[model samples]
Target: MGRNVLVVSTVDHADDTLRARIGDDVDEVRVVVPVVQQGFMDWLANDERAATHAEEEAARLEEELPAVSDARKGEADVLLAIQDALATFDADEIVVALRPDDETQFAERIAQEDLRPSVAGVPVRAVVIHEQG
Candidate 1:
């Protein structure tokens, strides 16, 4: 059977890289991002003080012609759902695409997760990509 590869990336740009590396070897490419949902919920479920703060920031950014905070609740939700999806999908291998500099730190975070050890038992590969100057 072909390898079921899980590609965990912090940014969507990694999708291109995954397509390149995954060429023929991987039968499927699943993306995992683990922060998107929690951040949005924490922002959305704000108490009076926090909501006011967010509104002020949003206004300030707009007045300054800065970018608006786009609603990425879905992305965040997907990120927070990583472990669950991993179990559900039964991926044979995990290919973590990280910047070379942050590769160690990212791996460390995964190792620290409660579910990581069991998941690690199934082959996990970390693919670090060097950044261009």
Candidate 2:
């Protein structure tokens, strides 16, 4: 029998082919998505004036968008969350399916961590799923 596998997804969308492959596996598979806080959602959906201002601010920081300290902290938090979620499941592997063009920081974070040891022996494979045209 196949071992359990967990899929961490930043987006709800997964292509049909990949989904089919996942379903074909005999082991259990679970998909986990990060929840956007209400405040963050509101910021994203702000009025035209606010949205423009926010965009301008972000653009201004493009040169140094993610400082090393901040990036490390975010990755650590994600690692902990992933650990907690996998705590109860008997997973033999973890497949992280992230969008190629996503602006979210999940992919970068996971790529920086040591998956095998962090997962307590469960092998982890990070797969970047680029959207098909």
Candidate 3:
């Protein structure tokens, strides 16, 4: 059996860096895109925009990877989504793809060092994915 990889990202999909990092060693890939609430008012209103975007993001990611086993929207918080995803995916490796040069609070939440200790001690790899407009 090959490695099961779990990816959590802010962008639409995992980039070439991911492929280069792991090569063709991937057996199964699960990509989760977090639905970040834009602001307090949007959170209160339960806006669907964020979720809609995440769903689309996950779909695009699924389309990109041939080994993708699962792709879906995760919790609003990226870290929470990664934690919850692990409960079911049983991934051997975890990849957190952060959109570089992003100034959003969502980007700030992902700390490679901090995320490493969690995820049941799985090796964590952080990669920069530049989102295209």
Candidate 4:
């Protein structure tokens, strides 16, 4: 049976790297893009019409993500979102895509922390894809 891989990316294009890493064992690749909701308080205080507009904008942002199977909002923290997605999908593997020059401290956290396996209730291999320039 093919494995289900959950790819959480901050980049615009990560499919090529992901495909190469997973090889032929992947049956399905679920993509998640974590977004931070700015001006959330203002939106909450706005009128019905403005609130509706905010909702539409949020939906649009979700649509903009590449191969987005799920968009994690409210929680901009990628690690937390990955944990949530893992529980929701029960994925066999987790891949996190980031830029080479960008330092998000996620790589260090993932390496030192045992959160992934604890949340998955099994050994979950976490792959980090640093985008090549």
Candidate 5:
């Protein structure tokens, strides 16, 4: 048995980057791609486009990372998604990938400070990665 890590990110995690952040002894990795609703209108529209993008991103990550135990769509809010995942996925650690702070402040913008309180006990690692071009 090994440690199970939960990866919550908005971008496609490259192999090197993922390895660097996740470190060693990761027996299982469950990925959660957060659906980011663009605007209030998108939210009112049920965020169909956002949901589609999230699923596509999750699928891409799943294909890119063969060792991944599971990959699925998560809520628009990253914190909520982590909480939701923790309910079902037994995660020993959590790695959150986010855009740089200087980047646009989207709804999903989260830092280690805000994340730590939401998920107590479970250690969290946040990586500042640029969004894929």
Candidate 6:
């Protein structure tokens, strides 16, 4: 059997980009879009709206990348969501798609600290995609 790779990103990544990085050894690719809640008040007020948006976004991602399975993490920390996806999908590897210009300071920290050895336990690869003008 081929490897299962879990891709965690805030935005959609091109399949060619992922395929180039992961190579042809992958049997399954699952995408996880992490939901970053702004604040407690905002989350409380917009919980339903957030869920709806996440659902729609996941659906759109699936439509765009028909070969991959897409999922959303609602009202959770990105690191925890990665762990959840790892278990849920039985992933063999993790690829974090990062856009340097768009990531928050917190996101940078998480990418450095929590995303790799702490969360995944499996092999992890971070692919930085520079934002195009």
Q: Which runs of model 5 end up more than 4 angstroms from their true locations?
A: 13-15, 110-113
Q: Who wins the lDDT comparison? A: 5
lDDT of 4 by residue, 31-105 (tens): 655442223453345335433443454345345434335543323455676777776786777766554434434
Which pairs of residues collide in model 1?
Answer: 33-79, 34-79, 36-76, 37-76, 37-77
Off-target runs (Cα >4 Å) in candidate 2 are: 15-17, 20-23, 36-77, 101-118, 131-133
Candidate 3: tens digits of C-alpha lDDT, residues 1-133:
6899988776554556666666687899999887763555665575698789889888888887659889998877666788888888888988877766543443234322255544677777777776665
Candidate 1 local lDDT, 28-127, one digit each (tens): 5455543421233453563344334434432332232211122111122323344555665667766555454453333324432433423535655555
Clashes per prediction? 5, 0, 0, 0, 0, 0
TM-score, candidate 2, is: 0.51
- 10 residues in a row with least lDDT, candidate 5: 104-113
lDDT for model 1 comes to 0.44
Question: Which lDDT tens digits does candidate 5 get at residues 68-123?
Answer: 88889998777788989999988888888777766534555542235663375788
Candidate 4: segments with Cα more than 4 A from true spot: 36-74, 101-133
| Lowest lDDT 10-residue stretch of candidate 1 | 65-74
Candidate 1 vs candidate 5, lDDT winner: 5
Count backbone overlaps in model 5. 0
Off by over 4 Å in 6: 13-16, 37-51, 101-113, 117-120
**Which digits, one per residue and each the tens of the lDDT, describe model 6 over residues 13-34?**
4445756776777677787766
Better of 3 and 6 by lDDT: 3
Which pairs in model 3 have colliding backbones?
none
Among all windows of 10 consecutive residues in model 6, the one with the lowest summed lDDT is 104-113
**Each model's C-alpha lDDT?**
0.44, 0.44, 0.72, 0.51, 0.74, 0.60
Scored by Cα lDDT, where does model 5 land? 0.74
